[model samples]
Structures are given as C-alpha cells and as structure tokens.
Target: MESTGIQRLFYILWAIIKLNLYILVFTLAGGIVLGMGPAFQSANDVLLTSGMDYQNITFGKMAERFKANFKRSNGIFWIFAALLGIVAYNLFLASQIKGLLWFILSFVLFFAILLLLVVYLYAVQYETTYDISIGNLLKLAFISVFLNFGTFLKVLFGVISILVVTWFFKGLLLFATFSLFLVWSGYATKNIRQLVEGKLG
Candidate 1:
C-alpha cells in the first residue's frame, strides 16, 4: 500500500510537470501575450477530459487542442481582461479616495473581483466542455457560482492553499503552480458540473 501510494504521488507530480511544460511551450509559441488563452484552454481541456490518465496526454494533443480553441479562447481572454482592467481601475480610484465611500467601494470591488474570478474559472472549463455561445456561457457561469456556492468556496480554498504553499516555496511558480491550480479547479467543479447537467436534462 505504501509503495502504491508513493507511485501514485510520483505519477501525479510527473503529470503536473509535463502539463507545466506544455503550457509554457505553447504560451511562448503564441508569444505569451497571444498564446496565454489558447494554452490555458488546452491545459484545462486535458485536465477535465483526462483527469489522472496522464498516459494519454501528449504534446501533439495539446497542440491540437490549442489550435482548435485559439479563437474562442482568445475571445474569453480579452473579455475577462477588459473586465479585470475595469475593476483594477476602480481599485486604483478607491485607493486615491478617503472616508466611508472609499471603504464601501473597496469592499464591493473585492467581491466583484471574486465574482469575476469564479466566473472566469468556470467559463474556461465550460468552454471546453460545452458548445454554448460566449454570451450564454458567461451568464451560465455567473449563475452557477451563486447556485453552486459551496463549490466556489472549495475552489477558493484550494487556490488559497496553493498560493500559501507557493509563497513559502516559490519554486512552484516556475512550473507546478498553475497546473496544480488547474487540477484543483477541475476536481472542485466536477460535481457542480454534473448537477448542472442533471438539471438541464
């Protein structure tokens, strides 16, 4: 049992390393700025579809997925970028102000960012899983966050845990961080996705 558990850990680590390499290579292939979206979508696709079945994860498959998702992934990326920019500007404005209004605005904007974060995470996963319009995808992801608030919290916790660990062991940022987060996001959202599917059916 102990040796089996160790082997499982090794396999998980190896998979994450390979995923990290794939994301890095593809992101650079698009010159980082252009590559970020498609690369992320491709990685998310593998995580959702393959789960722990890392044997089937190949660079060619990732490339194919990245090419297929390029346009739609970029659309999602730019939209979220715009929204995040707006919120960031608001945050900057809040920083310049003083008094109760500033406090309230900051508080509201904090949750707004969180809402956007949850929606963005779900949006990326749903894009790969469903063939829905981006407009409807955003709406569904937004609604799902509230409806599946527990899942949101679980994902949030996983993210925080990873971030905290990465803070102490910064080497993870080099490779494992994003891939680990993707793994957690895939696991955290699985049940909520099933529930949504059941309701739709």
Candidate 2:
C-alpha cells in the first residue's frame, strides 16, 4: 500500500495532461457554442441589450436548455475533465492506496480543472456577464471523468511535452501551458494522496 515518488510523479503528470486537453477541447467547443454556436448566438445579443436575461425565461426553461446544449457533440470538454479524475483513481489504486480518499482526490482534481476552465473562458470570451447553469457544468465534468484511460493517457502525455516547451514553441504555447497545469496538478494530487495514505517516507 505504498507508492514511490517516481510513481507519484507519473500519475501527477498524466492527470495534468488529460485535464489540459479538456481545456483545449472546451475552449474550441465553447468558441463555437457560447462564442458562435447558433443556439447561444442570441444569448449574447440579449445580454448586451437587456443587461440581464435571468427573468426572461423560466428557470426550468433555462435548465432544459442547459441540459440539451451540454449533451451536444461539442460538449466533450467536461467529459475530458472527468476522465482526468478517474486517472487519479487508477494511479492511487495501482499503488495499492485505498479508502474514500481516492474518490475525493479525483473529484477535487476534476472540479478544480472545471472551475479554472470556466473562469478562464468567461474572462476570455464573455463581454460583461453571461448566464450558465451549474447543473450542466457538473454533467460536463462527469462526461470527461468517464472516458477510457488509454486515450486519456495519450492526451495527457501530449500536453506534458507541450507545456514543458511552450515558450519556445510559440504557436503551441496555449496547448503547452494547459498541458503543464494538468501534469502539475496530477503531481500535486498524487503527493497529497501519498501523504494521506502514509506512503510518504
């Protein structure tokens, strides 16, 4: 039930990479959706004109729309994030770590990435403000969490290399930076898990 430092690092790296890939995908999809998707097009115009649309539609209508939009093909961003958390689960389990802690680590890791992505995207794309429901966000996060690991690892690895050399690469820097964060996040997460399980020497 002990994990070595090197093992911890690998899982950490994998976690971060997958997390960033979710960001990249989400950024592009969001660009198309909230950014320019036909469905969300009027959303911005309405906001700009009225200053708020919260009262225009019933909360139920808003929830329904959120569910429909989040399940669209372009909504794989959160799915990727959720997958990253599962990676954390595997890393701990493989190292013989156990208990509710694994699930908590995975959830926190997934949540942090999801929160960071939402904040970054809102700041980057929205004018002054926008309305998004939390229920859909959670749904997106779960989709990402539930993806297959082999695919997730490949994505995670790609992000790590990019992040490590982003400044030099220029055009790929966003991808690189995103990758770095995921890897770092994974490392931080694994270390925490190790400490909790008393695996740290």
Candidate 3:
C-alpha cells in the first residue's frame, strides 16, 4: 500500500529525528568548518539507504557514513563556499557602483544557483550510496535535476517547508532543522533513484 502525502511527510520527519540525528550532531558541532556538507551527505545516505530497503541502522553506522560522505563531497562544499564568496564580493562592488539592478540580479542568480546546487548535492549523495565516483556523480547531479524536475521540486518544497517550520519554532534547531531538511529532501528523492541510476549507468 502506498503512503499518503501526509503519511510520507511524517515518515520523512521521523527518519530525520531518528536515523539521522547522529550526523546532525556532527554537523552542528563542526558546522563552521564542515559547512553542513557532511550532514547533508549523511542525511541523504540515510534516506537513500532506507529507501533501498536496508534496515536496522544505528548511530555508530550513521557516524561512519558521515565521515565517508565528508570525504567524498567536501570538494563540492568548497566550491559552493568559493562561489558564495565571489557573489558576496560582486554584490559589494555593485553596491559601491550604485548599480541597484545589478545587485538585484546578482542576488537572484546567487539563490537560483544555490538552489540548483542543493539539488545537485542530493543527487551526489544518492550516487555516492552506490560508490559512484566523485567525477561521475557530479555529472549525474546535473542530469538528474533536469531528468527528474518534478521530484526535484518536491525536494525543494520539502526544504522550504523545513525553513518555514524552523523560523516559527526556532527551538527546532535543537531538534536539528538542517538534518530534517536533508532527510526530508532525500525521502522526496527516493522514488527517483532508479530513474537516475538507469540514466547514470
């Protein structure tokens, strides 16, 4: 029996609260240096692993996976950080030039690319679950987003929902909002694994 949308949402929430919290602990602890890259990868791994029908995950296993994820995708994290720095500098320059339109467009483009990069990271994690190479995984991330646009949007919505919820209940950070978002987004992408894998393979 297929789950209703509400049921799936609750399932996603519980998965984060349960299976993915260990990784969140690491993320919150090392967030400044790690930049949520490990957390996102670990949460994606948890959801993808579960989606693939694996069972009986433990906190220790999640932590090990978190380390592996950080190793595999840290480069992407650095690239994201660099791009953010560049965009910030450009925005500052635009402000100095009094180019209001340029500033607005740059800001919009930053977010647009950031959102796409978020989806790409999700795809990267899914690929990493099967031991796909970092190079190939990067290629698949780009393709998967367009190939599975609807699923991408679902994941995006799940992410935005987490932000909204977190804004209202700031205490949710204690409960690990970023972890929840990753797991929720991962759950949203579960159905598309085969679709992506087929094309990737």
Candidate 4:
C-alpha cells in the first residue's frame, strides 16, 4: 500500500531528529576542519612571517604546501564519508539501486574535487604575477563540488551563479549544506541496518 504524505513526512522528521547528536559529531568535526583550516594556515603564515622574515618565505612554495594540506584535510572528510559507505554496505543486503549509489558516489567525488581545487587555489597563489588563470580554475572546481552536495547549494547557486559563476565564488560555500544531512544519514542508517541484520539474523 502507498504511504500517506503525513506518514512520509513523519519518517523524514524521525530520521532528521533521531540521535542528531551522533551525526553532528562526525559532520561538525569534519565541517569545523573544513571551515577553519584555511584560516588557521593564514594565521600561521602571519605569525611565523612576523619580524621581517617575509622575504625568506616565498609565496610559490607556501601555496603548494597549503594547497596540498587543504586537499588532505578535506581528504579526511571523504575518508569519513567512505567509512560511512562501507558501514552501509555491510548493513544492507538488498540489491543495490543505481539511484542511491549515484548520490553516494557523487558526494565522494564532489568532496574530493573541492579539496583538490582548494589545494590548487593555494598552490597557484605563489605565482610571480597576479595572473587569474590558475586561481580561476580552482574557484570553478570548488563551486562545482559545493553545488553537487545539496539543495541549499542550489538556492545559493541561483543567487551567486550569475556574478561569481564566471570561475566561482570565494569563501567556503558550506553555509546551508547540512540541511539534507539527515537524509544522507538516514539512507546510511537504513542500509547499514539492513546489512547488519542480514549478517546477524
């Protein structure tokens, strides 16, 4: 029998609120790192570069290290997501659907791409002149990944896609990215539950 809209809404709400604390633990940890790492690096550069040591510290070298670190920092996020996927796969024995896998895979790819682009952004900053070519590509790649993750990004895209859409918008675009996090969590929960039951039961 087809479920009523009320029932569906209830399910979604249940999923969203059910032990949100646990989900946020992982998400927030990842999000915080994603949000703060760059600022941290910038501060690091400022602090260490003080007292007339700026000449020794080259922008080109600094950019590469920063880009690589950002890529790896966000790599940590993807690693978390991948772990979630493995857990889900273990729980659910149902035939895999292309639809759901698409979502899962897309998220991974997008996250990784964003990380790479961020790395590239820092990496390119060390160039001799103020050339925008490298920075532009990094910006484009960053926005593409952010947009792939959620509905909020869509709304965000609609607003800024025109002006900043040329290469991309600056700053972290994760403002409302957590809106559908519950859905991702729910899907992960459901599949993992299925996989666990299949093995144990």
Candidate 5:
C-alpha cells in the first residue's frame, strides 16, 4: 500500500534521526562555533539530503558538502547582519529625529529582509538539489516566487502549521522539533522544485 503524506513526512523525520546522526551533531556544533547561521544551513543540508527520498546518502558525502554549506551560510549571516545593522541605525535615527520616516524605512527593510529569508529558504533547497551557484540561486528564487506565488504561500503555510503543531506539543520541541521541521522542509522543497520545473500543475 502507498503511504500518505503524513507517513512520508514521518519517514523523512525518521531517516534524519537514523541516517544523519553525525550531521545532527555537527549542526549543534556549528551553531556553537559559528552561530545559528551555519546551524541553519546544516539543517538545510539535511533537508536537501532528505529530498533524495532517504536513500543512498552517507555521512561522508554530507560532510563533503559542509564547506559549501558553511560558505553559503556565511553569506546569509552577513546579509542578516547588514539587515540588523540597518534596523539599529534607523531606530537610532528615529529616536533623534522624532519622525516616522526613519521608522517607516526600518519597517519596510524588516519586511524586505523577511521576504528574502523566505525566498532563501526555498533557494537553499534548489541549491542542494541542483548544485546551483549562489548567484543563480538568487535568480532562481525570485523566478520561482514570481511564477508560483501561490505555491510559495503554501510552503510558508506548511511551515507555520508545523510550528503550531510543535507549539501544542511543547514537550517534544526539544527532541523532535528540528526533525519535524526537516520533514516538512524536505517535502515542501521537493514540491517547490516540481513547481519550478513545471512538473506540477
């Protein structure tokens, strides 16, 4: 019998726990060594590997991609750092100028950064699945978002739904939250690729 989407998602979670223990450990270590940027990218690495339908993946292979993931994460870190810097500067200006202009600018930039974050979430999946360069990945992310705006919403919705689920099961957050997130990301990333490739209607 064929499995349902929930079953498949659970299987993806199990695969991560079972097959990618080293990656999980490294994820924790990366978070400590370099901050959550590398850790987030490490999770993306697992999401990409999970896209492979949980087959023929080895720790050595995932480890080989570490440098690339770290590089990608480093770029992401700087982008976020810049975003934070802008927000901080604008807020300081707002306090001094006593005007809405700086506050508005900061607000707009916050949403802009947030949008790019969601875009990059999808883009990293593409990068892992296709080994696309960062320059091309940015292009691909925008194209995917423009062409499949509805699909993009669906991906974000899935993530939010998962967060709600985890919120209800707060006790599991420590042990299972990351794994559950990977499962959805893995599944959603695959679908996003299909949408981008015109394979899904």
Candidate 6:
C-alpha cells in the first residue's frame, strides 16, 4: 500500500510538471498575449477530459486543443482582461483616498475583483465542458458563482493555500502552480457545473 501510494504521488507530480511545461510552450507560441488564453483553455480541457488523472496528457493533445479554440479563447481572455484592468485601476485610485470612503471603496472594489476572478474560473471550465455561446457562458458562469457560493469559498481557500505554498517555494510558480490550480479549480467546480447543466437543460 505504501509503495503504491508513493508511486501515485510521483505520477501526479510528473503529470503536473509536464502540464506546466506544455502551458509555457504553448503560451509563448501564441506570442504570450495571444497564446495565454488558448493555453489556459487547452489546459483546462485536457485536465477535465482526463478526469484529472493526467496519464493521457501529451504535447500533441495540448497543441490540438489549443488550436481548436484559438479565437474563442482570445476573445474570452481579452474581455476579462479589460474588466480586470478597469477594476485594478479603480483599486489603485481607491488607494489614493483616505478615511471611511476609501475603506468602503476598497472593500467593494476588492469584492468585485473576487467576483470577476470567480467568474473567469467558471468561464474557462464552462467553455471547455459545454457548447454554450460566449455571452451565455459568461452570464451563467457569473450566476453559478453565487448559486454555488460554498464551492466558491472552497475554491478561494484552495487558491490562497496554493499561493502561500508557492510563495515559500517560489520554483513551484514555474513548475506546478498553475497546473495545480487548474486541477483544484476543476475538482472544486465539478458539482457546480453539473447543477448548472441540470438547471439549464
């Protein structure tokens, strides 16, 4: 049992490493700005399809998935990126103010950022797993975040934990941080996706 467990652990680690490398290479292939969106989309698709087992992961598969959704992925990526930029700019402006108004604005802006992050997380998964139009995909993903608030909290905690671990290790940022994040997000949001699907159907 101990040997089997150790082997499983090794296998997962190796898979994550390979995934990280795939994401990096593909992201650069699209020239970073263009590459990033498809890279993440492909990663999520590959991970979900494989049931997180990562045993069937390959460069060819990643490339195929990346090319499959190249344009759509970039559209989704830019839409959220613009929203994030606006919120971040507001956050920076809020930091310049003082007293209670600053506190209030800061709180609201931060929450908005969180909500956006949650929606983006769900958006990627939804796009990968379903055939919904981009408009509805974003709308449903935004709504699902609130409907599945408990799961959202779990995802939030998992993200923080991963960030904390990576902060200390540093190297994990390059090697496993994103792959691990995609794994956690996929697992955490599985039920939420099912619930959303059932309701929509």
Report the number of the highest-TM-score candidate.
Answer: 6
Error of 5 at 10 (Å): 6.6
Each prediction's TM-score against the native? Answer: 0.94, 0.25, 0.71, 0.23, 0.63, 0.96
RMSD of each: 1.3, 19.7, 4.4, 20.7, 5.1, 1.2
Tell me which residue pairs clash in candidate 6.
none
**Candidate 4 C-alpha lDDT tens digits along 112-175:** 4445533332322222112335445344334433433453234334433433542364221332
Across 1-201, the per-residue lDDT of candidate 1 in tens digits comes to 999999999888888988978888999998998898899889989877777667877888899999999988999988998998899889888978999989899989877887787788888878878898999999888888888678889988898899899999988877798788788877888888888889877
- Model 2 gets an lDDT of 0.40
Checking candidate 1 for backbone clashes, the offending pairs are: none
The global Cα lDDT (0 to 1) of model 4 is 0.38
Error of 3 at 112 (Å): 2.9
Q: Per-residue lDDT of 52-166 in model 5, one digit per residue for the tens?
A: 3556445655566565677676676566567667766665666565457766866776556555655766665666666666777777876776666666666677767867887
lDDT (10s digit) by residue, model 2, range 61-171: 423343354443234334444555675565555446456876676566655554444332222122112234445444433343333444334444554455557757765
Provide the lowest-lDDT 10-residue window in model 3: 48-57
Q: How many residue pairs clash in each candidate?
A: 0, 14, 0, 6, 0, 0
Q: Indicate the residue-level lDDT of 7 in model 1.
A: 96
| Model 4 / residue 146 / CA error / Å | 12
Q: What is the lDDT of residue 127 in candidate 3?
A: 50
Instruction: Order the numbered candidates by lDDT, best leading.
Output: 6, 1, 3, 5, 2, 4
Model 6: per-residue Cα lDDT at residue 148: 67
The local distance difference test score of each candidate is: 0.86, 0.40, 0.64, 0.38, 0.61, 0.88
